[model samples]
Target: MDRNFARALSLVLKSEGGWSDNPADPGGATMKGVTLANFRRYVKADATKAELRRISDDQVAMVYRRFYWDAVAGALLPDGIDYAVFDFAVNSGPGRAAKYLQAVLGVVQDGRIGPATLAAAGAKPAGVVIDALCDARLAFLEKLPTWPSFGRGWSARVASVRRQALLISAAPLTTTVSVPSAPASADAVAPTAPPAGAGPHTGAEAPAAPPESVSPAKAAGILALIALALGALTAWAAHLPCNLLGVFCQ
Candidate 1:
């Protein structure tokens, strides 16, 4: 395994959390985000619930590699993009995650990573590809029936993953051209001293993020509304409080 890929998988595991048996969770009896069914399928072990609970860290890693990382060809992707795609697969599925990457790259979204998708990814800068993928991910998640139930956490995860992917993409191999540092404001000045024990001050922040493309955001909003409309058809589902959904309630 590539060291960068190993590192990426480590971060994904951290984000996926540990065992969960929430009643609302579709993936029943997941340990470290590997569903029980998937665990059995990948490990070829007809392990009982108790045995699954005792699954080793090595087992979990292997399962992730087989089902998610390797399935998405994580080793072939650029640094930040690799982790973003891998994590999306873990949360969503490998097929959907692959489709999201394809959508971002303007490739045929057949939900399979083919030669064309790989070629497009190879040609694009990692930062650009990662940002677009995360945007697409958030859009797709907003369309899920579970969004009202899990949107807040899901949105936060997307945001965090996007930032991390950008950081990783910027780390090595690329020149300053990926993102040029903005010039300091002509009127900018060092801050005055703080209170006695306030400690040292920090420097200028990064330039504001470029304005978002309108189409994805608009499409995502429409899809989220469609999902919300359909959610009303279910007796078990209700409009979650906007705060819980990570939206402005008022």
Candidate 2:
């Protein structure tokens, strides 16, 4: 509500030019065909539309609460950037703009846009689109007689909201497990250690030692068993006789 804050905000938004052209700009020249009173009437009528109402203050505030970062202070970005991002979110949907900002800022690439993404975006070099938007907001703000005072209050609110957004965005993320070693080789197996307080043999009965060598016949028998099980399953599935049907099917 500080007048100075509004003035500063108005200055920043006014400096950016294209904002006056926004469809939401109450005084846009594009709406000149309609009288001011008629325009207001149309706005009131449109406000009743479900889609417009869906994008009401509550929805916008929800999104604002998600991305507004205050703690970093004004150092992360100018007041214009905050206004621009919020407007972009409201107009284009927060998810898309957040993703675009993430891409612009080189943050995590998951596209569900949010505060961390916007903060990251603030770190990006201003591009053509960003510059144009900043210009528009600045231009729009500058034309308003009350902009100085209004902008100050709006900027303060934005700052507070941004702080909340940052906190939400900074919440601890879920963690994942990490294995310390590579998978064991096909031929390698885990070694069993002797139990505590035992002699060389150990306290409890020692595990059976692994075989030093494997016989070809034993391996062949194991393969035969596996083949038999697979044959049975195939026979059941095909509803065929086990032997001849199995050979033909293969």
List all candidate RMSDs to the true structure. 37.9, 24.0
Candidate 2 lDDT by residue in tens digits, 60-149? 333233332221122244343444454444333445444544554567856554567556655654343355444444444556676664
Query: Model 2: C-alpha RMSD to truth?
Result: 24.0
Candidate 2 regions with alpha-carbon error over 4 angstroms: 1-143, 160-188, 194-206, 209-250
lDDT of each: 0.82, 0.44
- Candidate 2: Cα lDDT at 172: 26
The clash tally of candidate 2 reads: 21
Residues 87-204, model 1: lDDT tens digits: 8999999999998899889999998776798889989998899888898899888999999999999999999899888888777765555678889775677445446776444564
Candidate 2 TM-score, true structure as reference:
0.25
Give candidate 1's total backbone clashes: 0
Quote model 1's TM-score: 0.66
Q: How displaced is residue 50 in candidate 2, in Å? A: 13
Least accurate stretch of 10 residues (summed lDDT) in model 1? Answer: 234-243
